[model samples]
Target: MESKIKHLEMVENIIERMAKNCFTLKGWGITLIAGIFALSAKSTEQKYVLVAYIPILVFWFLDSYYLQIERKYKILYKNISAKSESEIDFDMDTNNIIITESVAKKLCYFRCLFSVTEWLFYCPTLVAITILIRILNVF
Candidate 1:
């Protein structure tokens, strides 16, 4: 019975680490997307394309802001997990709470990335609609 509890605790610890790593990658992804958007905006000449990029800039801001929050929670989780490591019987409750909060932080970051995609996806369509309206006015 004691061994079983130890194994479960080990699994929980692994999960906590995995969640932290995933959030780190998500932060990197956000940085990449922001760089790409900024570069594209700089290289483009057309006014409509330039206008289209404003939303992406907003996405960049959101990504960088949340990345900071995720990093803080990750450190907090590591400290809590380390402090719990010496217990003989394994305190599952504290581990669960820390891990759950870490996962929640990751999920929030993921959600922000999704929001960025949604905004980017619709922007081109919006530009197209505006162009179509202008063309219709010509006829």
Candidate 2:
């Protein structure tokens, strides 16, 4: 039982680490794309501004996927932590917990992209991208 608890804690830590990395990568992607556009805006083709959206969107959706995975593992952690020693096992799988939330089980990157929390984070960048694309001729 003690070993099972320790193993679950270890799994939670791993998931937390990955989740932090996902957010870090997303922030870096935004920074890099913005930097590329800034550096090349004057000398490069104006249309290149539109290309920034590609990575931005990709990173945004990818971050959501990571968040989904993190949420699942968090759920599993809670479930395991709540159980009696007799109920806990070494199997530590998250799929069974996710099944109860069929909608969550079916969630894909594209769908997660539009999740309210994700939209709150990424939509403003998308708005900025659209405005930048519209004004590319001015740059």
Candidate 3:
């Protein structure tokens, strides 16, 4: 029983780390975009605005990857919670777990990319970039 608890705690720690990574990625994405925006404004170069897309897209993919991993761990946590003590082998690798078809679809890369939380941050950033590009071109 104690071992099982410890195993669950380990899995929980991983989930927490993944969530933290996603948060950190969001912060970095915003900071980089803001910096790029400043550069574009100061230089009056649309190129900087174009460069901003690299970080935004990269961070978006990374954030989605972390979210996907976090979700897998959540599923693993649920599976572990339902298992017998003997079944709790303290295995933290989520890839070993057999996910169902529907659940697997939800866990895919593109699905994670378009997930509500991901889209909420990245899509707006994209729109903002587009707006910036237009403003630069007009002025």
Best by TM-score: 3
Q: TM-score for every candidate vs. truth? A: 0.31, 0.79, 0.92
Lowest summed-lDDT stretch of 10 residues in model 2?
98-107
Candidate 3 residue spans exceeding 4 A from truth:
44-46
Tens digit of lDDT per residue, candidate 1, span 60-127?
Answer: 45544554454444444454545543443443343244445655655564454555443464355446
- For candidate 2, the per-residue lDDT at 133 reads 68
Task: Give one clash count per candidate, in the order shown.
Answer: 0, 0, 0
Q: Ten residues in a row with the worst lDDT in model 1?
A: 44-53
Question: 2 or 3: which has the higher TM-score?
Answer: 3
Q: Write the per-residue lDDT of candidate 2 for residues 1-139, one digit (tens) a residue.
A: 8866786987778698867877796688789778868865875566667678788777886788787777777777777777788876656576776345565654555666677767887888888778876777544
C-alpha RMSD for every candidate:
11.0, 2.7, 1.6
Top-lDDT structure, candidate number: 3
Model 1 misplaced stretches (Cα beyond 4 Å): 44-139
lDDT of 2 at 47: 66
Off by over 4 Å in 2: 102-111
Relative to the unseen true structure, what is the C-alpha lDDT of residue 4 in candidate 1, on a scale of 0 to 100?
Answer: 49
lDDT of 3 by residue, 39-133 (tens): 77788455767888899999999999999999999999988988899888888888887788999999998999999999999999999988978
Angstrom error of the Cα, residue 89, model 3: value is: 1.2
